[model samples]
Target: MKKLLCLLLAVATVLAMSVLPAMAEGAEINMFISSPEYADAVNELIAAYKEVAPDVTINYETTQNDYPTLLKTRINAGMTPDIFSTTSGKEIADYAEYSYNFAGSPAAEAMDPAVSAMMVYGDGEIHGFALKGNYFGMLYNKAIFEEVGIEFPRTLDAFEAACEKLSEAGYQPVTTGFAEWWVFKHVMQHFLDAASDDPAALVAAFQKGEAHFKDYPVLYDNFFRFIDLCVKYGDNKPLETDLAGEDAAFGAGKAAMMTGQGAWVEADVLAIDDALQIGFAGYPVTDDPAKSQIIGGSDQALRINKDSANLDAVMDFVNWWYTSDYGKAWFCDVAGVIPPITDAKVADMQIIQQGSELSATDGAAALSICYSSDSFNQAMGEAIQAYIGGTIDKDACCAQIEAKWVELDGAAQ
Candidate 1:
């Protein structure tokens, strides 16, 4: 009887050893992405994930400057992060060779359709997911507009008038972040939407060398006019103003309005003054108020490397981040971002709430900037900067931009 008991105990010990490895499988994931604005929130996410996945370790890294160039260098050196990020639409294809298409994965299924629409590769394969969906528009100080006694403008003429009124009342009318190259893409996309009923097709036409800025009155005239008004009533050092400068000016109540920024700035601006009333509206594109529609959808996409040594672990982390209760809540409660997944609660911030209301009431324009590669967008920004600095005439700017469209994007096609 004693011998029989020993045999049973040995069998139980073997079964326990087998179950322990299965339960405590360990892994490490390296996640490198842009938008360092969310670093703290992402770190919080990693901490929470540690609770659920005690054996998994995520090495998180991010940057705001020259992210694409650095990412390319890593890819070339065969040191790709387990997960990385790029712009969602056109760039998904640019990095498709290295990205995994987890089309039917839990995370992909939970994604908001508006965001997932931008992540598609060939034949409905989903190659990316977003940290947060986004909204691009003008952010203004509600207190300033109230003090000036004018409603937020919805037409180009009214916008100019509002600027004049605000200036007359001792407030800088606008804060343009002209120093950042990505700012041009944010500001130009609204004009691009107004220029064509189908902005994507129009952008594609320009890439194919079939469209010109001169051909669209909205692009050539009204958009430039709007830029001029912002400059005329803008910062004393408009060209020197980066996003931090813009935020400092606007947050200090010195500037009434901000451009080339969206929901992301709300937290920072409010951190300056929690009681500040913030207002959001579309850019004044033309004579028609309806043409001024808020633009919504994710522009940045986070992609998993298909060839990662720890692919299953990476997938599990993403799945939990997207679908779990704690993860869904973290987007709004912790990150204060527009949740990238459907049915998630919206952040209780002014820009996010207003952006949602405006998009619902007036409809949103497509995120046209996502249709072009960032390489082309960066070149376009430099040309516009030259125009702004008086080094190049408007016509010369257009010429340079058109040539670049063909030279950079056209070749890709």
Candidate 2:
């Protein structure tokens, strides 16, 4: 009876979501975004905007793989977008000169204090506001767990034991999308962060060329453990699977759980079976609970072009984004996105609830992007793929990644 009620609620929630109207107004705003990860949610938000404000058009453009370079090129060339998206920390510094200051807006005021601190710069100027804050860890199928008779695992040993049981029960223990560079990088960040005594300090040293992955035996061992998790229980030819395939496989109950996934996978999973119950938890990367933490934090932000002719419309949208109930509903209820507003309502979705609880605990770290570089992340990801593909030993993978970090540091000098 309880399961039936939950399924009905899920069905009704999807039904209540509004689709954007087919027609559009004349003016179109070119909005440059870094990735297609949030494309669907952004589109839904745009559609909702069109219904009330017909004249303002939002044309979404993605640089995808070439986002960082193209964004730099465009910003440097002064070919500014009417609106753009940004990530936390130094990433926003590149576009700070051209981004409009949101010093006194509702959006700025509503931002979480810590996240707001990351956006402010010279003279206390605010350059961007977080559009979505996410938690990344282990996303699992609740139904599979019930069948396997295993509760959530809070330690590495227990997690591995559950994986073994799930495998013996004729279910794939875990599903991963190592073929996708970002997915591999995401998992590596989680593993390395959990393995370190002070992930931030270690990463700072690595960034400064004072330390390397090989310098931390914990990282080296954990990297292999991560690989082992995928190799032992991942779907056949795991390296061949992409993000879409991995999500679909888990949605179809091919796997009991997926590590390194978070709230982002909820919609994809529920789409396959509205009745399927899903849950999320912190990745117990170590045997000791004190050291384990789920990777999460402010993932994306929104900024406006200081010189765009549509500043009024852009500002209007920005203000409306936080001040209006429609914006909150569209983001939280419709898109299942947790905006950074301090007053935002908690979504009734169970997986989101789980992520929130995990994030609030002492054992959670913000996505540690500030400590690593793009070159270093790419090298580590490639090495992990190679290691999992059976071409490189664990030591070779760690050594090459360390060498790549040193190489990247030298080139930066």
Candidate 3:
């Protein structure tokens, strides 16, 4: 297999000159962003950044139109942008040997430490900076809670009993769009993490081939419970419903609850029902002491390319995102993103208020960032889609994950 990052020097090849004029009078800088999810927000930020540095041009692209392949080719050709995201968990570690520290770097200190920590490499150096922080917990229908005469579930048994009641009343217990592979996997991982004490450690063990889901009965049981619930309560022909449809189903009051990140609660769903009385609770733990609360990390991370032509500008933008109050407010207020910057607060957002309250009393689950290699996510997604579709057996689905783990290990070696 060809190595992905610029791990080994490639044969000399002609490369395109993609660099744009920099913020400085004579410098040329081109900023390339890799996530499709943040393309609009990033462009908006770019517009703001250019107010101070009009000469600099921001070159933006999501992970779209085969850009991943194009990016790999560019990196190999040594035409890599001045600043580019590593894109996925696996890619971040490929260059870990030469990672930089944003902590002491002028751009980082303006933000809160907790958000900063998430951006650092395992070796404690910051390669990425927090664009913003986010909170991820369960979004439950407050109206449903009132109608059912139940409070948000705190224990695993209570959670199931609530599901049972919801099912009895013909109310879908959970709104899931397994049809969309990423949404399916994200929720599954959230449930497992919400219930686990050491989510990161458990995933690490699985990554190293030291553990399997079956080895963790809690994981297996939850997996079964989740799928069973889906079978029981999902909309008719749910396997046909796409992720957006799932969101619509839940947001439009077609479903009672959704296991999703906090990011979607206010922006996506609330718009559909402004009167929607929704509450967020941390992932429930079957085993009491193991309960963890989660505020999902922002998908927005900032990275500079090893070959970047305008490192200063890229770093400047990253710093502004964390340090500048205006920047923080856009993400928190307009976008409803939680600021990782410690002191930043939004007094008005209802979901933030709800999440802050839940987390305040240890009601939140300390959820881990659910990440592995890009291939790992893809493989898990494939298996999940297959299982949900009933096109594969459970053992077969587990086996697929194990196989992919070995495949990634071998390639990395």
Report the C-alpha lDDT of model 3 over 1-413, residue by residue, as the tens digit.
Answer: 46743433342222322344224564454555555666677777777867866876666666756665776687778777665555324455665543345557656676555445556676666666555556776778888877888877756677778888887876787776666556644555665575456766666767777777787666677656666665566667766676577668778887887764465446678778888877776666454533636554544455666445566666676677666766766676644556666666754666777766756676444334434665566677778778877898888888787777666743354
Residue runs of model 1 more than 4 Å from their true location after superposition: 1-25
lDDT by residue (tens digit), candidate 2, 310-338: 78878777777776788876657765676
Provide the lowest-lDDT 10-residue window in model 2: 18-27
Best candidate per TM-score, number?
1
Candidate 2, residue 407: CA error in Å? 3.7
Cα-based lDDT at residue 247, candidate 3:
68
Supply candidate 3's per-residue lDDT for 148. 82
- TM-score versus the correct structure, for each prediction: 0.91, 0.81, 0.82
In candidate 2, stretches whose alpha carbon ends up further than 4 angstroms from where it belongs are 1-30, 34-73, 101-104, 117-125, 196-198, 309-313, 361-363, 409-413
Q: Which candidate is the best by lDDT?
A: 1
Error of 1 at 42 (Å): 1.8
* Candidate 3 structure, TM-score to reference: 0.82
